[model samples]
Target: MSNVYIDQFPAEAKVIRAAFYSSFLALALGGVFGIIQTLHRTDFLRFMDSVDYYTVLTAHGVFLVISFTIFFLVGIFTWAVTTSLDRGLEDIRFTWGWYSLMAIGITMTGVAILAGFTDAIDMSASVLFTFYAPLQAHPLFYLGLVLFVVGTWVAGVDWFRSWWAWKAENPDERIPLPTFMVLTTMLMWYIATLGVAAAILLFLLPWSLGLIETVNPLLTRTLFWFFGHPVVYFWLMPAYMMWYVMLPKFSGGKLFSDPLARVVFVLFLILSVPTGIHHQYLDPGIAEGFKFIAMTNTMFLLLPSLLTAFTVVASMEHGARQRGGEGYFGWLKALPWRDPVFTGMALAGLMFAAAGFSGMINAGMNINYLVHNTFWVVGHFHLTVGTAVALTFMAVTYWFLPQVTGKALWSRSVALGQVVVWFVGMTFMSNAMHRAGLLGVPRRTAEPQYEGFEFQAAVGSIGELDAQIALGGVLLTISLGMFFANVVGTALNGRSDDLPANEYAGALSGPDDAPLVLDNLKLWTAIAVVLVIFAYTFPLLSIIDRGGLFGPEVIPFPLTVESATTLGFALETAASTSFESAGEIATSALTAVMR
Candidate 1:
């Protein structure tokens, strides 16, 4: 029998099991809301009232993007830390502490969102994941996220502590590849969390509590995006880790270049935070020059992803060749399609490649003007974090579960069918959404009201597109059910099976070939912080200059409950409320700051 996680360390297996359970629970809930929201968006299905649509959309975004994605990352990182270090956690009790904190945090936030369904509870957090003010959520939502983020930070420290202890004994050896990946990704996350934390504690949470009634809309928004953009990479990094480390094994090949892998991660740390301003290109408060700088940085950020595409493909090719395949592109046929783990990950990568092109357009200063806030943007991300990160997680679960549980998959065919259905569903849905977007169909609405003017599609009618999206959504939901059945059956398995070692492929050019500087995570982290400061300082100062602290006065409006006209902060400082009379407050603050 190949060495399994269960056979080697049974106690640790329980931790991984809890993590998986947490993950799939989120996947199940997220999958349900996702399909409902999709159907509602296309207008083919309309059970959710127009008023409640934003609530469901909030659930879809938070459950999938925040809860589902992060739970899986922590689980995968746990497995990575334990398996790579070849040592158990510092204490399983400590491990569960962070897990419980995260679970509690998610529940608190989830309650706030679900509470929005009824007026009986005045508490509601329908302010979607962005939480852009002068639209605010309940204080519980911010507190929940704080608990969640802090939990992750502690989890990182746990992993780092594990490595530090291991290194002391194995002083001569380099950090294991998995451990290295975990550490760097967590480091990036630690940096990323600072943005959101400050946004919450200093501003959003306080404002929601009525502790501070007003906040600079642009300042809070800038801070949110500061964390916002890097969190995308945070979501993608685990999938990328699987691609770099696990996909090659799935293909029966080894990693192509370990050194290049280090370089890719280092690039992400330095570039991800600085480029967040690109998300605000359409916003009014930020200057054109700052936007231009962000655009340039955003463009440079693509280079790492492009390099990743090249390296991942090369590694898969090497695996194909090792399996006795020959040909320029024909070697693709040699890949392990029979294994759901291999097929799901491969298809996820294919979708990500397309998502990448769309992202570049979104990053473009000029092109973004044509398609901002349309279903095209929705379609673009569904292919990325939605399909790419999410699909990869579902796929890896097939392989990782058995390793942790010491059992064979319940049914390989079911797992295979699950991934295929997901890819087919996303393809139909994403394509139609993209097409409709080009026809000027706006995104994120319940009814998508369109009686004023008929949207003429170049290739198909609106009815046809809606039908495709609805059909695709149904298929996707079925795929999620199939995934659940497979997981449940495997978890209840009565017998164990012999399996290959739970190990990733090594690189052709190993860590020995990589420069020593790549190991200096501290140096990289410091540089990353400096880059963030340099990029954000100017735009933030400009916003502050325009609006005083607590902002040049404004009123809060609930975006989900109010009409479109209500989105803006209605009154200028002259009519605005503050700690004192508006003029007194503005003049005093300006004088205090300048002095």
Candidate 2:
């Protein structure tokens, strides 16, 4: 029998393959919108008026971040849990149930967003991914997100239960490293999602349905970001999983430090949630002390990624050395450069190193003034989430697809070419975006240039920068095409009777070298929750005390001047109602005195 995943565990392989396909569908959709956006914004092309830009932007963010990312996570985490435990899922029916629920949620949310382009639908939600409240989206949008979040929660539970079952059979063995990573990440996920749950269920959903008249913008924003920052970590940890478990093996060596890897995940679980306030440093309503705490935590959070860089690089170096390579950096040339999996992941990590410096500037409370909401911010995240997570996922597909299908790779050369194209394309686009941002280019705008100011570059004209951006987008779009073609072709034609068995590289240092405390997930979960309460309690209270949960409401700003001016006029009137009420009472008292 073939030692591939499909031969060893066919049912689990099917589930994983299904989830991956769903994720790829989202990627394809997101890529279409991504190209359209880059072209339209750069004035390279225009298929729709500027009014529709927000709609497209909303789709791109939601589809890629929520759908593409989480679905891949579900698949990969499922694979990790199953492969590490050496067991099939406890119940195939329950497994399929969660997948179905996720599909429905994504469909519902996507429909609500796509509706924005048409006048035919009475419902539309162009509110963008932040979904900043007081800027209402259709109720279905929130409803859809609610289902999605719940589905993921259940999926996490499924993993936990599987782990529990494994323990009963081998009660003395420490939890496997891959299984430990999944459990800890899921624990953090449950803690992180509470903020968004409260935001949608209690606030945005009701307000959108007209059950409530107004919402506190600060509170909603705080809640959104409470979920937001931690969510970034959630996206990243799976990519980290591949780095720790899969990458060294692909490089032809073992993982360097098992114990340090556990510590890195534990640090993320504790640090990720408490640091959300750094995102709000520029907003006036929040106090500075809170911002300082968040900034401190944010800086501390950098330790793990730095540790990761050192560990991953060291592990790869070991691989090269094992292959009879020598010297400080000369061993880098001995790596499996032709392997798409290794190259894609290595380049993604390289981009992440660049992203880290920019992210530090964003996290620093004082320095935030320089890059907040600028293309610099966008560029920073694209390098991290866009490349680090995304490229890693794409690269993983190159290795993982074959395991489930019992297939030889379609063309190693084609896969290598695709990853290189992605790296080169993103370098052009992200570098231009970073430079444009330093020049104060506002992001999320249909047209970046304004008549009042001319954007002069140190090295080139603004027009030239736009050309670079457009060219990069074109290249990225082409890369996506090549990737899709390779994957689809492999899926169809990649069967081989001689496929190798599924395996991860063993660590040079084993889990026995690590302290047992690392496996104490219950204790870690408790600490994570405590940190979250400490981080959010006062900030949330201040928002609610200054404004009630529902009111002392502020009108949402119109996205465009051409939007209903009448709505703004009405908001101005309603906002002055308290003053009018006080004046009416004073006038009545004065009239009585005269009498």
Candidate 3:
């Protein structure tokens, strides 16, 4: 009999399959919107009105980053907990409950965003992914996000429940590496989410529903970044878990060091939440000192990533050597290049190294000014979450789908081609984006070119960059199609009894080799909470003190063209009056002083 996951835990497998399907659905929706925006922005295709671009952008962002990635990782985490512990969920019903909550929540949020395309629904949420203040969305959007996050919170509880139960039975044993990873990540998430939860529940949600007259935009932004920056790691930790636990096995070697992996996760848990202020380096209201502190925290974050790089690469090398590969660089040939899982993850890691370099530039407050809110930032993230996280998930899906479904993969060749094509497409797209950003091109706009103004490229014409972006978009669309083809084909295939057993790599330096303190979850969580408090308490107080809890008498954003025009005129008039009053005051002060 095959020792696949389905055979071992049929009920849990079903839930995982459901989660994967949901993730794929979101990926499809997001991919469609992704191509639409890419083609429209590059002027290669203009089927939709430019006004609809923000709607498309919002959908693409929410569906992929919020829905797709989270849904998929939840499944992965559940699997990690179950497979590593050799136990089924304590309550299968509870598992289904959380998944259902997530599904319903995202569906509601998705509907609100899609409603932007039509006046028929009398609802719209064109607020992009950041959902920054003044760009208000419907209450349903906020409510739905609440439920989704809450569902994740419940999911975290489920993992903890499993760990606690396992600990009871194996009291003296160290926490399993995968479980340890999931727990640490969840702790970080819990801390990080407090910001967004406060932002939405206390401010954004009520404001959107007309319960509040106004909000401090800077305050809301600060709250968002507190959640925003760490959320990057939330998306990334699962990918890291896969890299640390699964990649070595696929490379034909055991993990190089379990202790190092635990330390990396611990570092991430402690450091991830406090560094979000770096995203707001250019924003007013926050002091430069706080921004500098955020920058310092962000730089410290690089240590965990570097450790990950060293440990994962070392594991891969050990695997290669075990396969009789000799010499330093020559051992690379011994890797299982034919396996989409290994190649995809390896390439993702390589791309992440590039992301790290660009990320440093972003973390540096001075250098960041050049690219803040520019296309370069967009390019940098595409390499990080776009490739590193997305590619790793897709590649691993080849292995995971069969395990869950009891079916053989339809075409390994197509799967391999999909990963390669995605890498190439992103290279073309991200490179052009970075180049354009360097030339002062702005992001989040449907039209980058103006009638009288032209962006002068150092080496190439703007037209060339547009072409590259369009080409990349087309190639990416093709890659997505290939990926879906494999998925559908596998779902249609008959059950196979020859599937590989469900397992992760063993460590050369096992958990026992590590100090007991490494597994002290309470100690690490305490430290993480302390760091977050230190990083955010003063900054939050300063923002509220300067900008009030409700802020100045600021008008809500204008949605209609007429309203926008009126607001513009009003702002211009107000500015003129203020300047005149300031001049009179100065004149009066000078006369009094002279007398």
Best by lDDT: 3
- Whichever of 1 and 2 has more TM-score, that candidate is 2
Task: Give per-candidate clash totals.
Answer: 0, 0, 0
How does each model score on lDDT?
0.87, 0.89, 0.93
User: How do the predictions measure up, each by TM-score?
Assistant: 0.93, 0.94, 0.96
Candidate 1 lDDT by residue in tens digits, 185-280? 898888877878988999889899999979988888888998999999999999999999999989988899998998898899888889889999
How displaced is residue 575 in candidate 2, in Å?
14
- The candidate, 1 or 3, that scores higher on lDDT is 3
The regions of model 3 sitting more than 4 angstroms off are 568-595
Pairs that collide in candidate 1 are: none
Question: Least lDDT summed over 10 consecutive residues: which range in candidate 1?
Answer: 565-574
Order of models, best TM-score first: 3, 2, 1
What lDDT tens digits, residue by residue, belong to model 3 across residues 1-595?
Answer: 5689999989999999999999999999999999999999998889988878889999999999999999999999999999999899999999999999999999999999999998788788888999997888999999999999999999999999999999999999999999999999999999999999999999999998899999999999999999999999999999999999999999999999999999999999999999999999889889999998998989999999999999999999999999988897999999999999999999899889989989999999999999999899988999999999999999999999999999999999999999999999999998898888888888999988899898987799889999998888888899999999999999999999888999999999999999999999999999999999899999999999999998876677625456558878998999999999999999999999999
RMSD (Cα, Å) of model 3 = 2.6
